[model samples]
Target: MDFDLTPPTEEMEKFRQEVRTWLEENIAEEMKESLDADEFTEEKYWYWREKHKELARKGWLNPTYPKEYGGGGLTGAHEAVIVQEMRRARACPNLSNRRPPETIMVWGTEEQKQKFLAPLLTAQMTCWQKLTEPSSGSDLASYQSTAVRDGDDWVLNGSNVFISGRGPGPAGGPDYLFGPMLTDPQAPRHRNLGYFAIPVRGPGVEIRSMNLIVGRDSHFVFLNDVRVPGDHLIGGDHQGWQVLSTQLEQEHGGDGGGGQALAPDQSVENLITYARQTKINGRSLGSDPLVEQSTEEAYIDSHIDKLFSKRAYWIHESGSQLAHEGGLSHLSDKVCGIRNANRVRDVMGPYGLLGIKDHLAPHGGTQEIQLRRAIALSHLAGSLNIAKVVLARRMGISRTQERAAPMRTSGAKAAH
Candidate 1:
């Protein structure tokens, strides 16, 4: 594998300085404190909104998007500088969160772009992927959240589980849902889906929080008779499934699951610290060859994950279409993250399950917290099996695209 990374040009450096300056000023102290404390209270949610708006207004949030709709209209290289700066500041969200707006720009109507995509540029709204169902385990086609046509409106009914929407970040950006638009209960399996946005705060929309390990939480949203206008639909009627497939492929190809990138990656560092503090026969735990080996493996996997993600980001950001890179990166990230967590647990043994208040818990019990999160990550965003399927299809070893195409087209034809 090529280990070389492209160096930023002088222009990028100037942009970097400009970005750093803006972040230094606009990133609030309280928001920073919240991140340090890993707190996501309602107050912190409001802060996420403000921060997103500022970043949007400054054209930093949508750096690679067309400037006409609140983006900076930049290239991959430009976004890299912005990302580098944001990573250094420990502000912003995962690269995945940054993708929905781009998808809106691509598949949404011009008006939709203006109303919804524009805010993404300016951080005026926060969007979550409300795709998972109580019964569907990492299967988008199996989504049972039905949106039936009612006069000029679409009345939605059903519940989505495992939505990873934190309280609007530290900004007051109201939450929205990017999920399946097709809801015909009798439709064929893969065809009964299209993607669209639904205002999560609308009437009949009830979101109950589900706590993860530590202070983190996911959401369970119930869309009970929540009505959305036909205008909110993305792509042609029943064209949603196809559009959604394209979006996922593009997301994997381009961003490698890059969302808002709000949090820093401190899992490996915390594990290392824990190992150093631990004692086996009064010697540093890290001194033990087995422990050292485990830590080294984690360090390597984490490094590979970052590099793989960067490569995928570079491919997508450079205006290239990714066939396998996105899936590869995503698969690697999940594998590496889960693997690293297990390794840490092995290193810590019983103490890895300790709570933050426990004296035996190292790094405020981050290892234990990570174990919980790691387990969730297995199936949360996308399961390993799902990633592998995507990768295999992208690599032409699987005929899912062919199977899916026929199903998607049949659904569209049925709608007509």
Candidate 2:
């Protein structure tokens, strides 16, 4: 409920100005144009690589991570400024910038951090989470991947589906998986899970791109007796579940998901601009009462989404861990995703239905892609239903109490 501004430090304000200057000079027009391009051609890949390397060299890619490990070590406020600048420039984040190495940092050994964190954070390499197998979607505890101990090494064998990976942002194909393999069949349900740093290109590893409803591919990686050194195993032989939580934190937590997605201000600005220019029935959409009303509604929805997200971000930053309530962050995420979809469908209408590749439709800047991104984000990121379960447990309410309370009508009497 508190609305007082969390003032940025003088250092952060200066950093913002520096980032703005660099973005003005470095963000290429070609990269911006490719936002509407269909194919992830080779040239597009180069642009993505160049941008990532540019940011890496400038120490801007890993903002808010440890500075010693190739991160910017910037505060949350500075990160917000950087995200705002990127959205304003209409330059999408380099694909590497969105990878899942931070999870490794939290759960991996000091040696693991030294080996993978720097390259992953610096955008020198890309990583993906390979937890979701073909047979297991949400029930990860039941995964059948087996890693057997042999001398100082472990042999991994299993297949993971729906790995969200790309080589680079604009140019990269969805061709990779990132995470460790703990494929020990003999170990207990949770204990057998072992994390391995399997490279996507090794002899026993194979990745195939499976396109989704939204057009982007989710990699299906099959691991066949891949040999991994003892050092490559994350946090030892049976600590996979512990490390898994850390990775999940990155996916569900604030920074990774919060600032990167479509911002309210940016969405509102684009919607308003399209409304002003789009025409229907010989009248400018901006001037039409219905169109104007829809536009305002979209703005309001976006505003609510952003406001709740900002509140959650600040809450996390203010040294409080899950202080607001359990599942508050997840609730905000669902709201934001639904609100974004509504805004896109209502504001863009026929144009919104068209994919990013369609050049003939007006406002062809990946808005449709952005909408589907929200939906996928809502579903895959975490189950909203699971979130409610967590919240119910946190609030000390039994499942029956919570479910029954919602169904009670005014005329219904409670039984003792």
Candidate 3:
């Protein structure tokens, strides 16, 4: 087993140069400056959206996706180069809500794919994953949101909290919202649900922003008797658990082989810079052996996290059976994030806690935001304990061996 990454071929190298040149010439300075902003503003949101549309037009947004669906229809290596160059330019567009489109590609009918997936893949619209409800966060099977069958539509009624999406103002909300809804009250746990795609601007769909310690653009979504066309229901009625498993697998880091290297965590890099620049007793703080050692540890931990993700990505691209790999990547990211946060605080003390509002905040207050994220990440995708349990189950270290969830790939692979 060679642990080294295969070097890019000549064709790949040429493609990389092409991507780098395109990004350098096209990415606006405003967009580059926005990357350092403390929070994503309404102006910044639209700026990024325009950039997303630009990439979509070039078919680079979903490069590995089939060309017929408005993707570049490129290979995984090509996609990796696009991702790498985009990150190198610090102009990567936000395409985080990928679960819906990927799920649709797997279980949807032809009409559904054309209707839902094309817009999503092409960046014609945005989407939000309404998974966590007011009553259930981790235990998704216990979701109380109900979708009752109507003549030719499904009437959804429930509230979801901490829902994430792009855009800021009411006019800037996502074009679609998707998640599991209880369909059969009398049925078994996994069989009682239906997955749906609800239009955010449609009647009875309401969104209210939630204020948090950190400035994350999260919201509370209220669906009151929201009517969704029957065709919008995916994977057939009562088979939502199966469709959801695909999305959850990706979300939990099971689908790490998305043909791109994980982007380096900016916060870690900024922390290192802070340690090297800040003065202590007329010498750089990083010059102190203790502070230097701690900073290096943080860097090492972040690198390890990226490696776990890379391995998972490689396994998926190789078409090998991917069990426990995604879990390992997800678990490593969460744990390493916590560890790095502690290291930052230990070295920088109170300065690490300063927000963007503070005049003295370092790196545009990203360190402060990272510390908050470290606290919130444990509960966001899945808790650290939940990640551990899932990894154990996937690795067959439990009472009963649990198989990894099935994932269906579309022409253009969804980004994690």
Order of all candidates by lDDT, from best down to worst?
Answer: 3, 1, 2
What stretches of model 1 exceed 4 Å from their correct place? 1-14, 33-38, 92-96, 168-173, 213-216, 250-254, 259-265, 273-284, 349-352, 358-360, 399-416
Deviation of model 3 at 25, angstroms: 2.7
Q: For model 2, how does the per-residue alpha-carbon lDDT over 222-315 read when each residue is reduced to its tens digit? A: 8898887787776656777656655554445433254553243554667788889877898778897877887877766666555656665554
The lDDT leader among the candidates is 3
User: Which residue segments of model 3 deviate by more than 4 Å?
Assistant: 1-10, 33-38, 170-172, 257-261, 410-416
Candidate 1 residue lDDT tens string, 57-114: 7777777677788877776666666766786676745322554665676676678888
- Model 3 error, position 328 (Å): 0.9
Comparing 2 with 3 on TM-score, the higher-scoring candidate is 3
Q: Could you give me the TM-score of model 1 versus the true structure?
A: 0.83
- Residue 299 lDDT in model 1? 78
**Higher-TM-score candidate of 1 and 2:** 1
- Give each model's whole-structure lDDT: 0.67, 0.62, 0.78
Which 10-residue span in candidate 3 carries the lowest summed lDDT?
407-416
lDDT of 1 at 92: 44
